[model samples]
Target: MKEITPNNTNTTNNSKPMQQRKRKADTLGYDLNLATSSGGETAEKGGDGPQRRLWVKDRSKDWWDKYNSADCPDDEFRKAFQMGKQTFDTICDELSASVAKENTMLRDAVPVKQRVAVCIYRLATGESLRLVSKKFGLGISTCHKLVLEVCSAIKDVLMPKYLQWPNHESMSVISDEFETLSGIPNVVGSMHTTHIPIIAPKVNVAAYFNKRLTDKKQKTCYSVTIQGVVNANGVFTDVCIGWPGSMPDDQVLEKSALSQRADGGLLKGVWIVGGCGYPLTDWVLVPYSQPHLTWTQHAFNEKIDEILKVSKDAFSRLKGRWSCLQKRTEMKLQDLPVVLGACCVLHNICELRDEPVEPDLVNEVVDDDDDEMVVPEVALRSEFASKARDTMAHNLLHHNHAGTSIL
Candidate 1:
């Protein structure tokens, strides 16, 4: 049934009504009414809506007045701008001072510090050209050019001073060995090949890494060999890399300049201690005397072996960068060995100074066993070992002339 309610008693009118009231005369109690003057807009309190970012009132000046207070257009950033300007001026002053110290050539160009920084960052981080250019605010081409120039300068200036050849008196002990690489065996100082497996190029693949099985011998990958020499303290004195692994040690040694010195010539009277690999006559290898006897020779040989093992680990951990050397690029193959030798020298310098080796493992000595004297049939297959035995036999052919005269 439809019923009529009293005028003031209607359900819609009976509900509680919110009384409309004006904000009490600026309750925040600021000096000026900034909200109304700035064209107040509807703003959501929490939900997504337009925001009111009010400007604080100041007695001394207005917003625009305070912002552009002085004649300088950007008064807000003036202090920071001034700081940057002062830094720029200081750099200019330093450049001027440096230029004053120089003659004509260095005065009108890029500063020496920048060049040094470019080279140092390149060497230490091995960063690419674009990254270096961005960091130094230099052109990519400029960074590349500076790096090459600095490397060349270092090679020319520093190498001659620090990397001169050691005299006979300077080197007390020398250790030598041959390492196999790319099927070519080169008579090297240490056998720590750290076998870097390179993918065979498309052409002449077999020549680089032979994979075919032959009738009379075993199948082997094509690899190159590097021959190196280290001093008594474990620094590489010399290195000859890039002979094929298939090449015999004797052939590599015979052609090497070091071999010429070994033939009773340049390095006369110098005694070299070598493992069973090097075919040089002036070297002495430890004998398996009396079936794994704990003699002086055995201990010495063990020491040499330990040194090589440690050196290999150290070389493997080297963080140094290497540039691919190509013959077509007019780069010499010898430079690779030179850089390797430099690493070894640096290694030795660190070792001699009692600095910790990065590898952090000390060489361990194994217990001597009589079984070690047992020569495997593989010993006969080694050309170097066979030649050394033959040479020993030939040297033993000398007659006792003094005993004959006494008798």
Candidate 2:
């Protein structure tokens, strides 16, 4: 028997550049309405395990052809995909090489633009896969498979370009903006945690239960957490996603790669302001959590809150733009991390490009309650960090560090 080798493979079993493979009816999401054409082909019968009929079906993708006929109405496109045409083009261009597949005997490889559109629209609308399948003229299984495929490409290809830790110069600029926003010095980012609802897993179901959220919202809930640190301009710089929702904010912080970086002195002398959910530390400058606040503490909370709002608003837009994260999703439990990571990366891109959320877009995902004043999971404060809060409070109350004096 001849062994299967690359050179021995059939000539027809090969991938082609999209430019070379473009056909008349091949317009999936691309704005190419060159002309209308269609063709059909037969596939070789598979191995003789069991004989079956050919597997291609006739599904009409009229919706894509109609709306995608022109450049696609800018407002309408953004509403459907959560991004404008330019942003969509950029994603398709970047992920094409990675997402484009080889022509199969049974069907042509899904087009790059269509693959991205399917995933983005599903995420933006949170519609069921059945609907997505009907909309894109693909099998339900195909739509689900493409979502994960394109998401993996985004994480691999676009993440490094769009999402990153700032350079030294960028960090200095971030610190300056934070200082101007609040009296906090050397603060590079604002941090917040948001939750995404997921279907309960069969095993270890209790771990994923969000008791705090369930108790407060009066709905049985299961979720995974996404902890984001955003810069002054509301772009995510770092994210720790997919932790069990039951963990406290401090515990999530303790387990993050960001925390590990801090342990290596990466966070020395800098602060990332967060809500009361985080205990004040050398690097984490949270608001005063005292039962009774002094005048200075009151002033400090008011000012520092300005920084925390940056983080909260960033996550709010994240859930708003990617409606899939706003509610229970059809994605499987194991596949959510890739999906959420893609959303964060895309969020940064949309923000950097100055894309505005649609006027009707609202944050459907419920925000977490006020942080419980969780203490630092470990002794992360030094003598300098311990005194840093007092000095910051006094300065906020009495010095020019504050924008205006309350007294």
Best by lDDT: 2
**Model 2 lDDT per residue over 1-407, tens place:** 12233233344434333334444224342223222225222223356433222222456888876556676688888878888888999989999899998776444677888899999988888898878888987767778889999999999999999999888899999999998888678999999988888888777889889987788789989999999999999999999999988887888888999999988998887888887677667688777775787778778888887898888888888888988887787677888999999999999999999999864565454676453545555534556765888898897767856535554
Compute each candidate's TM-score over C-alphas.
0.42, 0.84
Q: State how far residue 61 of model 2 sits from its true place (Å).
A: 0.7
Report residue 360 deviation for candidate 2 (angstroms). Answer: 3.4
Output the worst ten-in-a-row residue range by lDDT, candidate 1. Answer: 321-330
List pairs with backbone clashes in candidate 2. none
Count clashes in each candidate, considering only residues at least 3 apart in sequence or on different chains.
23, 0
Best by TM-score: 2
Candidate 1: tens digits of C-alpha lDDT, residues 69-174: 3443432322212112233233234334322223343122446555644554443344566566656645556666665554455444444443344574454323
Model 2, position 294, has a per-residue lDDT of 77
